[model samples]
Target: MAHPSLTETTARVQEIIGSDAITRIFRDAMSRTLRDAFVHSDGEEVFVLTGDIPAMWLRDSAAQVRPYLPLAADDPGVADLLVSLVRRQVRAILLDPYANAFNARPDGAGHAGDETQMHPGVWERKYEVDSLCFPLQLAHQVWRITGRTDHLDAEFARAADLIITTWQVEQDHAERSPYRFQRHDGPPTDTLTDGGNGSPVGRTGMTWSGFRPSDDACVLNYNVPGNLFAIHVLGNLAELATVVLDDPALASRARDLAAELAAGVREWGIVTHPVHGRIYAYEVDGLGGAVLMDDANMPSLLSLPLTGGDAIDAEIYRNTRAFVLSPDNPTYTRGTHAVGLGSPHTPPDHVWPIALAVQGLTTDDDAEKRRILDLLARTHADTFRMHESFHVDDPATFTREWFSWADSMFCELVLDVCGAGVQSTLDEEQVPTP
Candidate 1:
């Protein structure tokens, strides 16, 4: 299936956004990452490699195409691309739910040595919980917005069951789980201590993730945000099971598991900071310890609302927000170009556009949102495309020259600010008929 040329897609986006300068920014940003990262095979498969790397991360592939879902209902080209990507993601998950990233084909292509379990199709086997959650999130979005469920076939149902089972095992990770990972040569964060299993957790009801969304090993196995996200997407899975798959038993299990996880989170996830009152921790154990810092990634404490886990206005969330965005949080950085959060995965003093856009998306303050937009618009470093992270003091000096997830998120922020309702452009009369 041939997609619309870049020109046509840009024109459609521009027509929807309705702001000349902002549309130009969106067009340039979307064109670079979306056009470069995605590819469709001669078969009924599609693949989306992470920017500058020829591998598809389950987490990234889901996020990189999210901004297109609402638009898919209107644009056949966008719709086809997203639908194909959904099919590809379902195949990857069915291949291995424990594997976070995969090669385009069953060829020995990536990270062949850092061993937990190796598959020819898998690029890296590091088990980040968000990697599993993201495919469900994307599938849910595609179904809700486009009303297309053909992609939700038998294999997709099997993958959903696998995810629930994995989470159930990880709930008792120390005893029941078999996943382990070790990287001989890399940064300290890349390798887990205690041989391959990550730091110990005390069965906090939350599922264990061996790695963070940054692909860095977790200091505490039960990542608070990831568990929160699991609850949200598990609910999504429950609905999908009942409505799409028509399996009430599977739906009941998902709902019960989500409720158990949420109960655990409420018990151990919230900490009373002296300055911030009750707030969410980045990572926690069922024991007493908690990491009171946030990274500049989705599923961070700052992104609860964005992930559909919690409302931004919830009291504890507001408290967490203040702590996450303030200088008191060790990862929060203030530079000449921007003031936002950074991650250990990148260099010091670099701010992620993803964090900034998420802030704008979750905030109700118009002025604050505009301020974030101005910072994002000005920091594209003359390329008119978003980068992974820019130097806190110097926007031009950035990392990851081509990152589609960040680019897609920036496009989402643009759509929000420009008052472009998600499906507004796809109204019956406005949609082009072939």
Candidate 2:
């Protein structure tokens, strides 16, 4: 059989699923909007949005279109577009290593860049560590899937070094760096303390993250899932150094960092669940304190598999899963329209489609997937687009005018179920990579 373009495959799905079917809903959503959201308009950079946030969050943009890596590989135009996006992100880091978000083009507002502003788009600038981790993951994944390395250039290497330096500084935040954000528009409790600079902590091996992967402020000093992602990021860095750059020294450094991070997680990031007995914590301080519940975000406890953490011990993960999916987890919510998790970012009753898609992707039960699929299809409000979060009880009141990450993840989960080669990198990394 011949490989089909996304349109043809999507046509097949729409054929099987009524045009308004569960999976076809998101397929059509992306069909109408993804190109515009992702393609660089006005020749700026292509930093996708989450719903309608005008600013391009470094983290969100990378994860948003990541599912397209495979599809882009097969289509040169899309592949070129992704490469262009990566280059734009690399430029942002070079301009301001501290800010995690950037305006696709400089508006003379962010930290300073010689690069000219591309019209109709400007990079949003805010510093977040995980933001640096994402472009490497995207570039590496695109290269791995496409067998193309045209975009990996001197700037990427320079960005890698800047990331290393930034990471090192963050590891010792008590003394090294000076960065903070305080959003006065929201409630004082709704925002971070100390101007969002973060609370202080002891010198543990764990790296400091000003923001969680959720792009929100961290309550505790150490974020377990973010650290888990850091471990994965370090692994990818090593792979990129070796596979694409042929820089064994950088690869070794990344490997050492990954080891250090894993050890830190072992030391500070896990706890003994009475039920699971040895489940990981959401965030930790290495000072005998840990947050136990999970959120509905990527790098979430639920997304262990998607983020490259394996369920090596089914019984333990099963127990942990039961705890999270049940009433025990604070963020877990259930309603007539949807039943999943919600973060503080949304109203109490609202649930994120990202979480539902993740619930579908991570669960082993067909019934659970179907239930989630049902909720997802019903909650889209017939725009055929996924929202950042829907009112779990109501399924209507959603946020964001443009959200590309949810759209991408929804697409990836559907593709995975359809045998679209969305291979888990967990197993590939479990053993040594040659």
Candidate 3:
């Protein structure tokens, strides 16, 4: 059920937009993305799927609910829903800290054939680092905006400890970790190298991920964008430990790990581009090799500033922006309909709407922000809901028509451009780090 306050706020936002057509689109997107995708389970839990899929992703679930955090304070029902979702995520983490997605019920839900330990509740055991980071980011934002820590129960504390432990083990994956994954009869990008263990990382201080945010296996184990996201999430966990959990030992552990990863990124993640000067790499092996391209995913190199760990004007980030948005990056594409970033997981010449929104959110220039908004407004395929990725040549032919994460992101972008009244309370710092 939609909260009364949420409905009231939507009306105010429509007034601010001052366009009946755009306001109707925004309202439709909110209903489709935020309201329709939420499921109230039997155990005081909320399960959110990425849409057209029957499982919940830790990253996608968090992003789907994030636009409602600011409104949580105005509506008790909204706060309850957000808190319940946080609790559900904690339960999912306890089920398998390494698993990126989960089933609402244990019915052998996802990827039964993958060469990894399969649990009944696991949707897919592709171990992406951003999966762990996003839940913490959402939990932190809920507490920050609502001035409440009711979500920090004993289960949450246990989940936080498990997350930190898993990250530490992944930091030494070459010798200490036992996790490996393989998928048969799939594309090369769908499976890992070195017999299901990913490519060699040389044990850099940054943690290892079996997959990228795109659900494609990493060519190099230490994904730089994932590590940068870790740095931000670890800081969020540290604050939660000290202020909410009152666990100094856990806080110290998080701080120490964050420092080590930050140092590793500074030492090895930046490379000298012949044309763009110093730029951040997408993936790096400690043994002096790096992938230079960026994906259009949330944890991609181009999303660093929007993801909130790095400053927008930082020298390396500027250089990286120059590289990622230009012809240099393989995934950067241009066509008659649009020009933006894409990913290896999608068809050629397709651009992601989330990436376009991230570019607008991160840019300080009003004209550039407006331009990106215009692009988004034009490329919704007349559905008023964002897709996973749309064709650069034709907006009508897009991928993943029911993806709620993209729709939620588009809703956020609309609120920003329309200057919604409720959005006035939404501090930039309170935005989802994912």
Candidate 4:
């Protein structure tokens, strides 16, 4: 059954958007996750699959349902769905803090052949920092938007502690952590280096991430964008700890960790490019190696304003944004139809709709946003749904015909342009200064 609120919201959007194509895509994208991706498990848990993939990625699931937050405030059904998904996420974290995706059942499903610590309930064992950060982000968002505390039960508190501990262990990964991942007969990015321990790195206060949000191995290890996202999420966890969990110790720990990561990023993440001036690097080693490109994924350098808000330096972000959107950045692609950020995860000259949506959401220019919206409306391959990536010159050539996260991102950008976007709870005061 469709949520009544979603039906009513779609009707309102139809009244606001003038283009028939835009309205049709907006309605489909807005309800895609509920209609196609969500799977109700036992009890109140709801497992949300990343479209076309049978597994549930912690980061993708959180993003797939985020556009529905505004409707969650007034609709009981929407609120319950959000709450249930958070509960499910908390359980997944407790199962394995290092796993990025999970199986709905403990049937030893997904990547069981990969060389790593594989659990029956885990879909993939690639440990990305954003995987842990996203669950906390969703839990906090659900609480903030719906004023619900049932999702933040004792189980959630336990999961929070495990998440913090896992991050702390990963801070000195060479000596303290025992996590390793290896895959045979695959691309180099599918596996880590140095006997599955990943590349070596010095002691930067920022935690080490074996993989990026793109599910590609990190070259420099200490991912700056992932750390920045972790810093923002720690602030959210601190607020949740103090207000709901009644645990000042946990709150202080989260704040201290956030401060440490922020200090690390300030010292090592910024690079003085000749053209872009001072801007954030994508990845860095404490010993002075940095990768100066961004991917088309969440927690990317281009998404700083959307995720970090006023916590980031406004002037530096402006410079960084200018660099990432231009040809200066290695992954920025330009063609006849669309120009946006592309990912190493996909083929050359293929731009992601997710990046375009993020670009529209973070911009201040109405004309720029409208231009992006028009481009998106025209380049859906007549499927009326967003795809993972499409050819820069031809919309007919695309990847992942059923990508739920990209669809949700498109819906979010459209809603923002229609003056109905949800405000992030990570305000200036809530986020730590970097």
Q: Point out the higher-scoring one by lDDT: 2 or 3.
A: 3
Over the stretch 316-385, how does candidate 2's per-residue lDDT look in tens digits?
4566677778777888888877678888777897788898888888877767765766667777886777
Reference-based TM-score of each model: 0.93, 0.87, 0.95, 0.96
lDDT for 226 in candidate 4 is: 88
Q: Residue by residue across 141-216, what tens digits does model 3's lDDT show?
A: 7887776688988899899889989999999998888788999978999888888888877877888999999898
Local lDDT at 279 for model 2: 76
Q: By summed lDDT, which 10 consecutive residues of candidate 3 come out lowest?
A: 425-434
Q: 113, model 1: CA deviation in Å?
A: 0.8
What's the lDDT for all of these models?
0.81, 0.68, 0.83, 0.88
- What is residue 26's positional error in candidate 3, in angstroms? 1.7
**Pairs that collide, model 4:** none
- Clash totals in order: 0, 19, 0, 0
Error of 2 at 73 (Å): 3.4
User: Which regions of candidate 4 deviate over 4 angstroms?
Assistant: 42-44, 424-434
Best by lDDT: 4
TM-score of 4: 0.96
